[model samples]
Target: MAVRDPAIDHLLELLAPLGAATARRMFGGWGVYLDGEIVVLFARGVAYAKTDALTRADFAAAGSAPFVFESRGRTVETSYWSLPEAALDSSEALRPWAQLALAAARRKPVARKARSGEDRRG
Candidate 1:
């Protein structure tokens, strides 16, 4: 079952503009898609985007930690990024970053390993 939170609902409303593209409810939150590709995960009221070195710098400049999925004494960064604090203060500011992520999602998703019966061992 999915847990409910007011903050997450508000975020979903904020992201509803792209709802027709692709989005699924899982892990107690929503997975946002752009052009049928998942670029951001809306969870716990934060936006986690498709990440890379350049994107990492962008988030740092905006002043926020990347949505980290694991931390065992070391900070492991994920594609997730909290909505910039400054952006959260201004509604206008949020759209640009969200657009950036959507653009990333529009790219072709990288295919990993075997598709089906092609592999039996790693």
Candidate 2:
């Protein structure tokens, strides 16, 4: 088993009411998975939840911003949004928001593979 981040562990505990949530370290951060889907992430003591176009307005209205990172000298914005400051303090407050995040995560399109002999060699 990989070493777990204590901060991530505590965060997961608070989110327990949401359902079976598991955290795994990835690229110096943590990925929070629920129901076999990644719904949240923990990094630098902040929790970022998944968001799609349909759900981004909620975060925006709450004054939350999408996760941004600099890669190769360019800023990259992701679909994940930081949880509201109030929600970070209480699991009860975060429940609804987490649900919306999970719903948005499920909305992402799944990758499909090409069928056998269906692709051109060009």
Candidate 3:
């Protein structure tokens, strides 16, 4: 069963101008997608954006921290950071940040192993 949250739906509406944003239940919250790219996630009433080297500085400049959690007796930080304060209310304010996140998502390389049916000889 997929869990749903009204706040996530509201957030998607707020981000609509950027593109068609959709949400899916994931990790006890929701993963927000824009043009099929996962740019944001919501959990515990807070929102986080996917971050990479290209976008990390912007979040740091905004004083936002990467999502961290305790696991296996250690602290683990994810590649996602909280949305900049300026983005919380206005879609205009969030456009750039969402663009950056989308860029980062595009840059993230996908891992795919070679299929046995494929010929490897070159």
Preferred candidate (lDDT higher): 1 or 2:
2
- The residue-level lDDT of candidate 2 at 8 comes to 76
Lowest lDDT sum, 10 consecutive residues, model 1, at 85-94
On residues 1-122, what C-alpha lDDT tens digit does candidate 1 reach at each position? Answer: 75656554555556556454446787767776655667667776676766554466777777867776555788676667766765544436656776767665555367676767786685
Any residue pairs clashing in model 1, and if so which?
48-80, 67-80
Clashing pairs in 3: none
For each candidate, give its TM-score against the true structure. Answer: 0.63, 0.86, 0.86
Query: Best candidate per lDDT, number?
Result: 3
Expressed as tens digits, the lDDT of each residue in 13-81 for candidate 3 is: 878998889998888778999999999878778889999998899889999888888899999999889
Reference-based lDDT, each prediction: 0.63, 0.85, 0.86
Off by over 4 Å in 1: 1-3, 18-23, 71-75, 89-91, 112-122
Instruction: Give the clashing residue pairs of candidate 2, or none.
Output: none
After superposition of all CA atoms, the RMSD between model 3 and the true structure is: 3.1
Q: So what's the TM-score on candidate 2?
A: 0.86
Q: What lDDT, from 0 to 1, does candidate 1 have?
A: 0.63
